[model samples]
Target: MPALSPLCLACAAALSVPGAAWAQAAPVTLKEVVVSGSRSERALDEVPASVDVLTGEDLDGAQVQDIRDLARELPNVSVKRAAQRFSGVSPGGTGRDGNAGFNVRGLEGNRVLLTVDGIRVPRELTSGVFGSASFGRDYYDLGLISRVEILRGASSALYGSDGLAGMVAMSTTEPAELLKAGQTFGGRVGLKLDSENDSRGVGLTLAGRPSDTLQWLGSVQVGRSSELDNQGTNTALNSTRTAPNPQKDEDVSVLGKLVFTPGGGQKHTITLEHVDKSSEVEAYTGRTTSATSGSVLDLDGTTDMRRSRLSWDGRFRIDSAWADELRATVGVQDSDSREVTHEQRTVSPTQRSRDVTYSEQLWQGVLQAEKTRALGGDWSQKLVYGADVTVSHMDNLVTGTGAPSYERYPLKRFPETRETTTALFVQSEFATDRWSVIPALRYDRFELKPRNDGLYPLDAASLSDSAFSPKLGVIFRPASNWSLFGNLAAGFRAPSPLQLNNYFENPFGNYRTIPNPDLKPETSQTLELGTRGSTHGFQWEAAVFNGRYKDFIEELVAVGGSMFTPADPLTYQAVNRGRVRLHGFELKGHYALGKATNLRVAFGQTQGKDTVTDRPLNSVNPAKLVVGLDHRLGDWKLGAALTHVAKKSTSDIDTSGTPNQFATPAYTTLDLSASWQVTPSTRLSAALRNVTDRKYWEWTNVRGIAAHSPVLDAYTAPGRSLALALVTEF
Candidate 1:
């Protein structure tokens, strides 16, 4: 089938001004503003892309404490959660790594960009001897976030890199957001409890305006939790155990911001943030007796992560006509992850220990400007230009006392590498009453400079690359209540430092990973068409998108040699693969059933395949349909949500692992929630999740698990659970 030529012609026609009356027709007003879609505040419907915004109230009502919880509320978004079966010698990707980042439109990991307050978040890391260490990208505290915006589809035209699939932007709360009119000081305290994880949490936020020009805000959140519950019932101490391993978790997050407005058309904000999370696990599955010949007795492990960031941001209303506003931001961030494992065996060595640590330090700066101009005949245009520069240093170390002949202690998996990226972008929007055109372009240059010390691998080398991203969007409003939009965008992701220089060799095992300095960046192009309308208290949106990705970086592809050749270890290198095609559609709407009641519905489905091999992509999520109903009377609100998921068929899976993978069955779940305003400044919310206690597994979580494993039940999601929260403002 050919592309939509009519839409293409219409977009081409949009370049020339249409003879439509501007003041006669009024577009539908949603009254909701968003910034991530276009890097400027605009009506939600005005953005020519698929975007979802979750406000603080939405987060509080849903009890979204982490990224895993947040995924339940969005369509075409998923987070992979493996079982707690990781060991010191094996930190498999399918094992206990917590929430392993997000998958949007079948693309995940470092392909998606995540940011907070315009500052980039650190990428996920998983590299060491035999992949024994891993770090995820869940360093956010929902309590301090005022809003989160998700932009679906390619976004590299604006963000430069790490936006090949999508972007998640978060904005923290401001002092004025919590303060009432004329109030000098205000704050909120919150307490939450959830049965799914047996977790307890507390959050405190304070804001004060000492003077007219100065305002400050501070927030702190703390949580303590145990292992998450699953449908598994077995409590055995060996590998047959179906229940979650005994675990303890603790986390703390702190944020501070100061805003100053000296009345010279300028405002400046200083921000300080810190987050720390730690977890300990007792690997009962690794415990065994000497008679079993398991060669192991006990195993205990702990993982610790910490991140700190400081930044200054300035916004100014420039006097020049061409540049109406100017914005500048500079920041420094540091993140560290450490994993320690101890094993006591019944074998000759008796005891073994492994300690691994990874760290990343970054400095970044951004400058941006925006302007709006009026053309003749009621036509108008807005221009946005920006520059971004970032420099980062990363290093990883592994030390162990497991005196295996082939294993050595105190070694570097990847040498210290300095990464730098510089980019410039410009976007323009031209609009009239009936039509609008948006075009954007960005250029980025990235360089990786490795410190070639003694730890550096002789075969590894530095790398430099560049990319150009561009996008075009067109919107045609045929009626006052309707909008038809089309967009074509390009995105790219540069290869990671570790992927280009990682060096690992196990002579005894006769397998090793070689560096690939010639690896190219992954690139993608997406075409989307959609329509949105509002009428009679009903708002709806439907979109269809097709994307093609090329030069996918496949890590650890067998390049030469054989595993049986001890003298010639099997060589595996990162290489670029063929093309991938993914297409999907989403439908969402909200309807006002009555003066006090509302109904919501959303459905999404995606299909992906390797164009060369004609094989289905396992990262693609199955179809999902969600329905919700809400009613409010006075200060009490009641809501119910029903979710139905399609089953994963055998054909959709790529079961080539040592243990064949299983297919998930279809399932449906219902949730009920209620919120009551007990007092003028106090509120309470409660939710009953998985009301039916149905047993089901998320495809992303069990993608690689053994089909016939006795612990299959361990991969099932939490059965019936309850969450409660209380908040008070003063």
Candidate 2:
């Protein structure tokens, strides 16, 4: 090596410090690697943002039912599904269950961006007159994932819109070609059962390399889960009746992928992937009477949902200065949901039936280039840039069935809508010895066009919006085992088509939604500070973030002003609101107690308020803590965990309107897990959740309704559930 420059020498000196090794120095494996946040493949300590990487081992030990289940051990994270407590979407438990969406640091819905294998997941949720649809309705089958990386805070600089809170990305499993030597063909089969809802699932995975230039992986899973009921104390005659009952869900999914590589001066790898999934849900609330049998309410509705995806990825690596690697991807996704219901009264043989269909289709393409170069002696840098385009289309149509005497719903709640998005992003990483810096920028443009079928007030709608997000992060390693980090990032979300131009009317409900074309994108600026260290058989990370949101887009109750008011029906128009402040802190750590035992703790707290109104924001999460211990004995591992959540006052639940939605009391539950490796290729795992069968409610799971209603039990937490998992590979 030649003489290094002064800056290079300084960098070398900083890196030379001897510190306790994190997971970074370990031999890199396809299945086990602690990652830096996305945009690069760096170690955790090398990244400035708050990043958490869960290994396959960590995921399996958690007995995760899905990706959402992993939130128990992570700070400031939760999941959301449909709730029946409120009319459409509310807090508490929605009697309905759909694809579980992510909520990070108190922000849920389309605010959190989700991706798989670096590809953006499509937004499936749309808005309609009756009920708005959700954006992400497809779940990442856990069985196919090898690693998951969670980046907390604004990530729009790297992922574009929908990353207002953070980004979650998972890497799929590799083919058998990357497996240990001498394994020509291998597969894993598993069976799991949950006591809470008598849920059961079977998973099968197969990977193989039949030739030197080809390798492949395939997975299949099927699951069924019943309703999770409360202590049954709410069924008393005096309790306020809840409309729809708990729902039963059955789901099935299949995934397949193939990879091929060829030799030469330039190596190229091509991959093809596809996935199909469907869920059938039965609304089993059954016929029930509230306080008294004053109204005849018949309940028998089944919802059928189907989603599919197909993708192609190509990569080329060559020895060059302009670019070291070029990667490209093309993918498509389609999702459809249908629900049918009928209610009849014998008094006059009056019948009401309706068929509802909500569907979305999307196509996208991405191209990226990566380059690495030495910057004078010890300093080096990696530059990554990418461009992507996406087109999304949605359809929401409804029709009446049965007798004409019954009232009929609107034929079109939400009109045929299309959104086209184009974006260019770039990120640079410069590192020397003890100092690492990253700056990223992304520019996004959205073109939205919604069709008018002669049903709404407008003939057609055309809108365009653009945003620029920027982020800068720095990491300083003062000593071998400790590092200080900080990040300033900007994020934004464009208004959904429904919010921009939706016209829905429900004569019976006395409410209507009028579009607001003047709406602006929701934007945020966040500043974060944190420190992470690992030494003396212990590791810890702590970070605090403060953010301000501008142009907050929300559905506000409109009384008048160029919109339908008391004359028509109460109007809930999507409009931009005043500024809001969001802040939160998180702490996590683990200590190795001897070589066979480990103890860990995770705590998180968040607060959000409207700066203009000085009132609490409904999007905040209650403070929570999770403590756990694990012991490993050769091939057997035993662990226990306790989750405690603080109670919330009326302010905690976004009392912008509803108070009961935020009504949650303090509660604690214990969980235990045991896993055994019977043989080199076989493993068995078991978990006892809510060992006390405690009755509690999570503010994030259900929509808000009055607290004293009988529906409370429907949204209550599951009690005394035992889950067991058995997997064998050969």
lDDT of each: 0.84, 0.70
In Å, residue 216's CA in model 1 sits off its true spot by 0.2
lDDT of 1 by residue, 128-182 (tens): 4435567778777788888989899999888978999999998888998888999
Q: Estimate candidate 1's RMSD in Å.
A: 4.0
Q: What is the C-alpha RMSD of each candidate to the true structure, in Å?
A: 4.0, 6.8
The best candidate in terms of lDDT: 1
Q: TM-score of predicted model 2?
A: 0.88
Each candidate's TM vs. the true structure?
A: 0.95, 0.88
**Candidate 2 residue-wise lDDT, 260-341, digit = tens:** 7775523333333444443333333433344233232453455666767777877777545556768788877877776555
Please list the residue runs of candidate 1 whose C-alpha ends up more than 4 Å from where it truly belongs after superposition.
1-32, 91-93, 127-130, 289-294
lDDT of 2 at 111: 83
Residue 366 lDDT in candidate 1:
92
